[model samples]
Every structure is written in structure tokens, then in C-alpha cells.
Target chain A: MTLTTQQSKEAEIGKKANHLVLVVTNDTIDKVYPPMILATTGAASGMDVDIYFTFWGLKLLDKKGQTQTKIASVGNPALPMPNIMGMLPGMTAMATKMMKGKIKKYWPTIPEMMQQAKDMGVRFHACSPTMGLMGMTDKDLIPLTDSICGASTFLDWATDPNSVTIFT
Target chain B: MLGTSLATTDAKPAMVLDTKGLLCPAPVVKTSQAVKQIQVGDVLQVLATDPGSKPDLTSWSRMTGNELLSVTEDGGSPKVYTFLIRRMK
Candidate 1:
């Protein structure tokens, strides 16, 4: 079949770039790290990586809310303490601080990682419906945002045959 | 004599990246970024302390079309791992 110029251009892009698509739906520190780490490393490996932040995950894209993210000390099996103990006042803060201390020793903070990912050409997409649902406009998002897109647009990118989609 | 010949054949790095205290993925990330600073086919020498860097760098070079020419371990107190990678593209 004969291909038009636009079609061939898209075909060329598809042949050249392998895609890594991540759908992040949570905002906790632990939940946020995997997608960020994978996206950064995947981009380093020469993949075209995209992260679609929806629901709570979209909150990470917000400048104000991004800094407020905390590690979940309650109801987390990975925590050394019992759930009842985790209910104590300041437990979340203590846990978050402890985790941050450990991570800071050898790794970049989440915000720094996001910046590195952006520098490495990892594209960040904010969910359009979620933005409306949360009453957030583009001005509320961090400067790293690449696009505001709906699920269909994200799916179109994710549907590439060479792409791998991860949901967290 | 063998060591002398091997040393003579070793490719000198066009750039060096020190990621000694940094952990996994960071070293790889930094190496990827550093590789871009040099011309294609130039070698990038990366020094890292994370134990996982050996495997991570090996896989990264293989996946990114770069050549993993050699890996040297200092075996010091922190056990530094050094990698020489040639960017093919």
C-alpha cells in the first residue's frame, strides 16, 4: 500500500523510537518512586517514555501538592510497626523523614528525579478529566508538564506495538 | 608483558563521570546524560560505588547500542566499580 507523507513520517517515528508508557494513579512516596525511576531509566535506555498522571497521581504534577507528598505509615505491610502503632500522632511525619533520609543518602529526591526525567526527554501528561475533577488548571501544574491529555490521547500513544505500558 | 599490551590497547575515555556515592539508576541516568556530551564512538568512563551498577551499566550499554568495553573494580573500602562505555550512536 502507498503511504502519504504524514503517514510515512509517523512510520519513521515508530520505527525509530520504542515507547515506555506509565499510568500512575497514586500520590504516596513509595508509589511515586517506581514510575519516576522506571521512566528516567527507560529514557536513558533510549526509549520514548510517557507518564500519564491521573486521579491522585495527578496531584504530583501540582506545584503545591507535590511537596506535600508523604510516605504512608498506616495500613502498609512493609512498615516495621503494627497498624495500630502507625496511628500515633506524627508517625507519618517520622516515617516520611526516615525514608527521605535513607533515600537522600544515595538517590535524588522525587522533585529532582522529575526534573532529571524532564531533562532526559521523558514526557509528562496531566489527565484532562482529572484536572477538571480536581478544579486544577494548567497554571497549577509544575513547569515540567508536557501536555494536558485525555485517556484516548494517552491510549493512542500507549497502543504502539513496540510500547510497554505499566500501571501503578 | 601481557598487562602492558592490554593497557596499551585500552581506549582512553573522552569523558569521565563520577557517580561514586550515587545509587542504581542514578549512575545509569548520569552515564546516559554524559554520553551525549561526547562525540559518537568516544568512550565515557563512569565511576560508581553502588554494587548494582555493574549489572545495570552492562545492561544499559547493551540496550542503548553502546559498547561496554571493560569494567574495573577498585575493591576499596566502598568498592568502586568503573565502566568504560563507547557510545555507538
Candidate 2:
């Protein structure tokens, strides 16, 4: 069957543009959100998306991480409670529950978003060097992770025309 | 200009997706999925309530190479935004 003109144009455009890459460097609830949001958005935009989790970022991929949402508030400027109060026991969980309540109506939860991102073809990469430092294995992370890779390897893949690479 | 205008003014939509009460990526993501269900060159009309969905869907369509035929805003208070997009791939 002959391809329609619109379909041909789409194929041509897809051929011209490469994927978007995001480097996640932190695990704190607030910090982890940026990369997740971008990866999810990139997938929805019909762009291939890769998120490389390194250092503390890898913690987010841990099965324990996404199971419970906790926002680090000790130094967070956005935290409504006092810094001293943030250090109090159970405050982090309280803050996390509050945040979850606020966002439940308007957005998908972090774990739900992660599943959706995966369904939309977003790739998650774990940093090998960081895993070695943290004494972790593939068993520690969620099943969505695609690879345990080095920085240079990902950098090599990221270098291209019209590719969006972000570090956060 | 002629082609764009023709597309914007009179391209009849093949499907309508109602995304009211859905927010941010939901509306945009739903539009993305809805576009895939139609044939190439067929228009998909999306009704979204999220204020952020317009720019998000606009940029998404740009990145995906889909044709954004028109965006019409309805009502004044708590406006309803309508997007008409044609499937390309």
C-alpha cells in the first residue's frame, strides 16, 4: 500500500530529529521531579527520552524510593515549616503526605507517572560507577531500568543534531 | 499560507477527545494517544480544561510533526480550550 503524504512527512521528521536525554543527579522528592516531568513530557511529545540516574539519583530508582514519597525539607526554601521543625521526627512523612494530597487531584503520582513514562518508551539508565559506590545491584531498583552504563557512553549517545540533553 | 488557512478553517475532525478535569501531562498525553487512533490526514478534536495544556500540546504537536489546525477558546470564566490536530504518522 502507498504511504499517505502526511505519513511520509511524519516519517521524514522522525528521521531528522534525535531523542532527548536527561541526567538525574539527586534523589530528594523535589529534586527528582524535574527529570521525571521532562522525561514524561518528552515521551508524550513523540520524542525518545532517556533518563540517566547517577549518585543520589539512583536512589529514586530503588524500589523503596518510589514506594513512599518523601520531600527533604531541612534546607528546602519551599518548605512551609521551620527548618528546626523539619528535623523533628515524622516531619518528612507528614510533608510527603501533604504534598501527595495536594497533587493527587491534578496529576499522576510519581510511581504512576513512571509507569506511564515507561509505557510511552522513556528509557531509564542506572549509572554503574554510582551503583558500585552505593553497593547496590540490579535487584535494588525498579524493573523499568534499561541499562547500567558509564557517563562517557551516555554522552556519546547524547551527541547529535537537535537533541536536547539536560542535567538536573 | 493558503494551505495553512484551509487547514485551520475547514479541516473537519474525525474524532473528539474530551479531557476536561485532567491536568498538565494528562491532557497532553491523552491527545497524543488520541492522535494515534486516527488515520493519517484525519483531524482529532481535543477538548481540554487544563490551562497549561495549550502550550504543552502546541509544542508537543510541533515536536511530533502533527498538524495543529486550530485552537478555539470557549466561554469567559474558566474557559474551555479546544485543539484540532491532524494525525501525520
Candidate 3:
């Protein structure tokens, strides 16, 4: 009834073999959700999950970026209000607040989600070029970040034939 | 396969974790927590209401190197998902 050592070992190898690579290029509240959800779920499922943050996405890792992140209600058809209505100056804040309210019920706030992602073993990688472009240093970001990496380095991780990759 | 009934199953599970209404990582997280309570090779039964629980638990089982012996819907108007997972490690 018991599995042989080799059989169990094979199962162990399968369990550890999966990986998910997520690339985040936007820092908006909507933009961050996909990778956050993916990373947390992927890592939770026993797969290795590494997220590469580049350009605007790097801002989300900054200590105060999430607080200032806005939702893209304008030009978004999913919104109840029209694009013209979304053009109002306060529309972004309103939309962001509305999103926060809706998401708070089921999902954690941005900061909490970020913490949870880290707790789930989701590795955060800050793109090196974006770090310089944003004029930000390691000290500017949260401690959750594993390291600053270049495109080539991130590509190497995504290039793994066995791993699933996503860009958001 | 789970509808076969646990009584006729090869081995009984150490615990049953009901994750109805819970979504996303909740089911997986709870399963991980419950899995620790059982010994190696012991099974854990999870009853969930979330549709996502299917893929979630499936991948979780695979990711943890566990054996997913069965997955089936319970009899009723709205089907519930039941997963029989054996802790391989």
C-alpha cells in the first residue's frame, strides 16, 4: 500500500519542478492585482514564483508607491461611468477609492497583499535599469525585494521551458 | 472518484477541511495548514464551495508533491467540490 522510495521521490520532483514568472510593468492598483494574485497563488501551490518589476511597476515596491497608485477608470469600459466622466480631475481618486472599497471586502489592501505575497515565498525582483531610471536605490524599496536584476537575468528565469510566465 | 464514499476508500484521512465560501489562497492555505496535522501518506479531505478551489487544490496537491486520489462533486442543487489528497512527503 505504501509508495516505493523511487515513486515518492518522483512525486517530490514533480512538486518542486514547477515555476511561475510574472513581469509587472504598471503600478496602478488594477495592474498590480494580476501578478499579486498569481504570485501568491502560484507560490501557495508549491511552485517557485519570481516576479520581475520594471518601469512603472517598480514604483509599487517603493515604500509609499501603493498609497499613491491610481486606478485606470478613465478609458476603461468596465467602469459604470463614461470615459468623459472619468476625465474629471477627481475621477482618479474617486475610482481608486471605489476600487479600494470593493477589493477590501475580499482581498487585502495593496500593502497587506504585498506582505502576504512575501509570506507565501513569492520573490520580488526589482529591475536594475528601472531602478536607475526611477532614480531609486535599494533603500527606497521595501525589504521584501530579493535583489535588483537586469532584463537578461529575468529572462533567464522566464526562459525555463518548464516554468509558466506572465506579463502584466 | 470522491463520490465513491470514503468508507470504501483504501485509507481514511486524518482530517476534513471545509473551505466553503473561501476563495483564492484561503483554500490552499487552509489545506497546507491541515496537511501538517496528518502524518506522511495520510489523506486529507477538503470540501470547498469556491469554483476556483478545483484548480487551486489540484495545483496545490501537485505543488506539494502530494497525491490527489480523487475529486468529485457532492450531490445537491449546487455541486460542492471534494478533494481527497494524500500527503506524500
Candidate 4:
């Protein structure tokens, strides 16, 4: 290929490769799938993927909390009515318990998903403020956390021109 | 109305990923890895379950600009889901 042609080809290749995504989730089991799925896909597509787990989302980092993460079905209009009917008075609490069972039946445990995310080289960040508020220390979180930072720190990573920020 | 199998097959399948018994991130994760090995225009066949794969595949295909040719259930295993994906370079 000629020099100009080669340069054009290189530019074309560069354009195809540019992808950056920032996923922020607040620990809702049902809500966690979006960010995890998006981040995994981004990394798979050769894009730089960063996931910022803040507030309740940070629970994924907690070894115990991750395995015990529950889905809130009460007041969540999305829960199937048939399933909701099974929950009596404290439906929210019952739904959470039932949802957890359903989730466990369908897919890998949250910790396993975390391992997969790490294996895919997806960057995992835990929010420091949330950690403090929840009274959780680094010892409580998964060992793979890239770092603990505040919202401003996450914003710095999300400001790139190619970065697509998503709040889940 | 036409069956999903009859849509089109002029292109060759570039990769085949068997994600049976795998859940959520595994299917997408494996598909992503498989896509990396093929060039644009190549197709990838993914077989998975976990229900979440449907939306996951659609969203990933849309996000990566890949063509999701088809997604069907394989009968042997009641939960089997298959996806035909064409790489978009």
C-alpha cells in the first residue's frame, strides 16, 4: 500500500477501535445487569471499560454482601404480577428473598460475575464515600477493586471525549 | 411470515461459540472474545441460555455495530439459545 493509503487505513482502524464507557450502578440486583453487561461488551469490543460502584452498588465489592445481594420487588412495578401475588403483606421483603432465589437459579453468583468482569480486564472502582457511610472497609470488598475514590475522581475518568457515561 | 432460519446465509460463519450452561456475562464474554478473532463480515454463532442472553446479545450487537442475524432456541436443552452474529469490523 502507498504511504497515503496506509495512513488512511490506519485512521480507519483507529476510528473503529475507539470506545470508552463508564457504568455507575447503585447495587440494585435487577439494575446491576445493565452496567455489567455494558461493561463486559465494551471490553469485548476492545473499548476501555470502567465501572464505578457507588452507594449500594459498592455491595458487589463486599464478599458477603455480593453473595447475599437481594432484588427489591415491592413497589417495583416491573416485577411480574403473578410473582408479586405470591408475596403477602411485607411483599417487598418477601419479594427480595424470592428474587434472590430466582437470580441464583438463573445465573452465576454475583461474586462469579465480579470474577468474570475482572477476567475481562474491566476496571472496577468502589466509591469511598459510600464505603464510609456503609461502614465498610477495604477488607470487606473484593480484592480486585482498582481503587476507592469519590464521585469527582470517577468524573475525571468519565470526562474523556470518547467516554460514554451510564448511570444504572 | 418467514421462519428465522430462512432469512439469509450468503455469508460464511466466522466463529462458533458454545455457551451452553453458561450464564449472563459468560455468553457475552465468550462472544466478545470470539468476535476479536474474526475480521469484519465474518459471522459468529453463539449458543447459550440464562434468558438474559437475548437482551444482552441485542444490546451488545447494537453497541458494537455487529449484525445479529438470528437468535433461536435449540430444542435438545429446553434453555438453549443460539445467536448468529456477523462482525462489523
Best by lDDT: 1
Checking candidate 1 for backbone clashes, the offending pairs are none
lDDT of 1 at A69: 74
lDDT string, candidate 2, B6-71, tens digits:
454467889999998887778878888888899887889999888998888877876787777778
Interface RMSD of each: 9.9, 5.7, 3.9, 8.4
Which of candidates 1 and 2 is the stronger one according to DockQ?
Answer: 2
Model 3 — TM-score against the truth? 0.82
* RMSD in Å for all candidates: 7.4, 4.4, 4.4, 7.5
- DockQ value for model 2: 0.41
Error of 2 at A62 (Å): 1.8
Give the winner by TM-score: 1 or 3: 1
State the weakest 10-residue window (summed lDDT) of model 3 chain B.
Answer: B1-10
Compute DockQ for each candidate against the true complex. Answer: 0.34, 0.41, 0.33, 0.24
Judged by lDDT against the true structure, how good is candidate 2? 0.80
How far residue B39's Cα lies from its native spot in candidate 3, in Å, is: 1.6
Residues A1-168, candidate 4: write the lDDT tens digits: 234643465465455534455555666777787677667667876678778888778888887777666666555677777665646667666777777777776566667766777888888888898889989888887788888888787777677666667788
CAPRI band of model 4?
acceptable
Q: Give the total clashing residue pairs for model 4.
A: 2
lDDT of 2 by residue, A1-168 (tens): 123755676676766656888988887667676677778777888788888989878876888765665688577768887788988888888888888788787777778888889999999999999999988888988898898899797887688776778888
Poorly placed runs, candidate 4 (over 4 Å): A1-25, A80-93, A104-106, B1-15, B20-27, B35-89
At residue A120, candidate 4 shows an lDDT of 82
Local distance difference test values of all predictions, in order = 0.85, 0.80, 0.79, 0.72
Order the candidates by lDDT, highest first: 1, 2, 3, 4
